[model samples]
Target: MEYRITDGIVEAIIESHGAELKSFKLLKNNEEFMWKADPKFWGRTSPVLFPIVGGLKDGKYIYHGITYEMGQHGIARDNEFKVISHEKNKIVFLFESNEETLKDYPFGFKLYMGYSIENSCLSIEYRVENISHEEMYFSIGAHPAFSTPTSENIEFSDYYLEFEKNETASRFPLEGKNISRNTIKFLENSKKIELEEDTFKDDALIFKNLNSKKISLKCKKNTRVVTMDYSEFEYIAFWNKVGAEFVCLEPWNGIADFVDASGRLEEKDGIIKLEGQEKYKAILKIEIQS
Candidate 1:
């Protein structure tokens, strides 16, 4: 099922399955700021990554000497979530660990995803509660694709991502499903990344060390812009299928396994170990100007 929240100025559509965001738009002009999920290009608009942000080494991880197999981004995105609340301008969806999840994750937990809008800024929250008696290790992240060039007169190349602060970050290029230890100089004391089809030719640009906590999608042809403040996230990435008209701003608390990584879960990169009954939260705020 799907639910909607509106603050008169804007509205968002969320669904129970995966707790994924289906749409976000301005009510006045009925203008959509999110990418339309087109199967030809990509089938997801906005999907939350949980338990793990990326892929595992050798398609599995070792936990306490036991091996478990998990695919990319974990199982939360494909699981069904329960609607916890749906008030005007605010909504929360809940996904608790189930018997099926334990087969791959081997832990008991609850994930809460909340979305709210006040004026033009949208607040997104991800909360994870460790229900297992033992210390639980996990990771979480966000993947939201926004439409670029909001007008027909402009092309995708006319848009760029402007960071809040100048950055000297290199991208860890993907080696198949895992991260390659090798790095490529992407931004060196620069703040803007020109959006083009070649930007994603080697897959998503993943950055672990960044000086900026926020970025804005802008174009030279118009005033329409989408800004995202991902202060709580440690790693950030930008990705899109080649030839697609949208771009994804991914904020991740953890990254995929490195090429020579140990298969242990606790040793995984950016793994979060939560004490029993403890809760962890990550938030991202988005402001849209159109």
Candidate 2:
């Protein structure tokens, strides 16, 4: 792991595998931002194609004429990436498919990720290039866990997503290999409950029709807040491990299973496709304050 710092921002490139974020900078109004990525703080991961939030059938997805092996969230997460460029307040990392990937994913592809800091905003950009003659399909997202204190004396229910508007959102549910059209509405209509063990009680909040580019998190004391924005994503997912203290607000170019489809990658809902030999791109931005 190595880091590059400039203009109050620190960008880390993990040369060991997939050149993940390693650590993201948190800049304040009058000071330089800090990067706390010692595994105990924050480590970055790029969840590819199917950011599988749960178990999938045999770690495989059936495509055109055969079945393909894909890890829980695809291969990008675990690959060693190279730092291609670094300058100013931004850094670019690149990851490409190899012999091992070809065995599972037959397409030739290139993924270039960039992290840029401008003032108080941190923007993440992902560019996917199709190198083969066939169309390429995949989903990409960021999984960055912000720090929280357990001794804060605030219950999980003390926090709620504060949308700019009172308009509520809806989401379909998923049951181990099955999709249920049963929907979960947001805001009070979805039932506000405490964060408990084994509770995703309402399933991941799925909002596909977003009129705004940002979403914010508000705590009971109104002390902590984090906002994320994405212009290219059509879906936003909010999730966490049953008892984990961290909440992941994910902006996705594609989504997981819809209530009525087989667990197939190419067939999964919200898939990103690149025309043969073309390129696809998307961005996610986060701003945190306390």
Candidate 3:
């Protein structure tokens, strides 16, 4: 099932499967800000990454003297969620840990994805509740793809990203699917990243502890802008398929396992631990200005 929400100026569509965001658009101009899920490039618009952010070492993890096998980015995005609430401008979807989920992730939990639209902004709220008796270790993140070249005359290189504040941070390079121990100089008190076709030749750029919580996607040829604010997240990344017409801005609460991982779930980097009955919430907002 799919739900729609609007606040006069902007509109959005949410799908029950994975509680994924399907569309975001402006009402008057009929302009779309989200990727169209083109199978030729990438088939997903916005996918929710949960239980884990990236790939595990050898695609398995050891938890409490037991080895569990799970794929990259965990199991939330490929499943169905129940629609718990629906309103004109707000909608909520729910996912719970079940018998199948326990086989891969040995924890009981409830995950809710709340989407709300207000004027020109859309907020994606992720709420997690640990229902288990013991401690639970997990991670969550967002993968939202934004369409590029809003006008036919512009090319991908004409687009650029500007941070709300200049950052002096280094990004961790990825060695295959796991995180490498090496650090590459990425930003040096700079605010803008000029986008090009070959920018992602080595895959996505993942950064940690960035000074800016908000980033804007802008094009030199167009006055329109798309900004993302992920204040509570510790990590932010930029990604895209080579030569594709879209870009992804990701905000993550946890990270992937290091290359020399200990194989223990609790020992993973940036792992979030929650006590029984505890709740965790993360908000990611996308604003569009014409």
Q: Report the number of clashing residue pairs per model.
A: 0, 8, 0
Q: Which residue pairs overlap in candidate 1's backbone?
A: none
Angstrom error at residue 165, model 2: 2.4
Q: Which of 1 and 3 is ahead in TM-score?
A: 3
TM value for model 2: 0.80
RMSD of 3: 1.0
- Model 3 agreement with the true structure over 1-290: per-residue lDDT tens digits: 87899999999999999999999989999898889999999999999999999889999999999999999899999999999999999999999999999999999999999999986789999999999788899999999999995456898999999999998888888888899979999888899999999999888899988889999999898787899999989999999999788889999998888899998999999899999889999999999877
* Model 2 poorest 10 in a row by lDDT: 29-38
- Candidate maximizing lDDT: 3
Q: Write the per-residue lDDT of candidate 2 for residues 182-270, one digit (tens) a residue.
A: 86764554323244444565556566766666777666764677777866787766665544465566677665555555756677776
List the global CA lDDT of all models: 0.89, 0.62, 0.92
Please give the lDDT score at residue 100 for candidate 1.
90
TM-score of each: 0.97, 0.80, 0.98
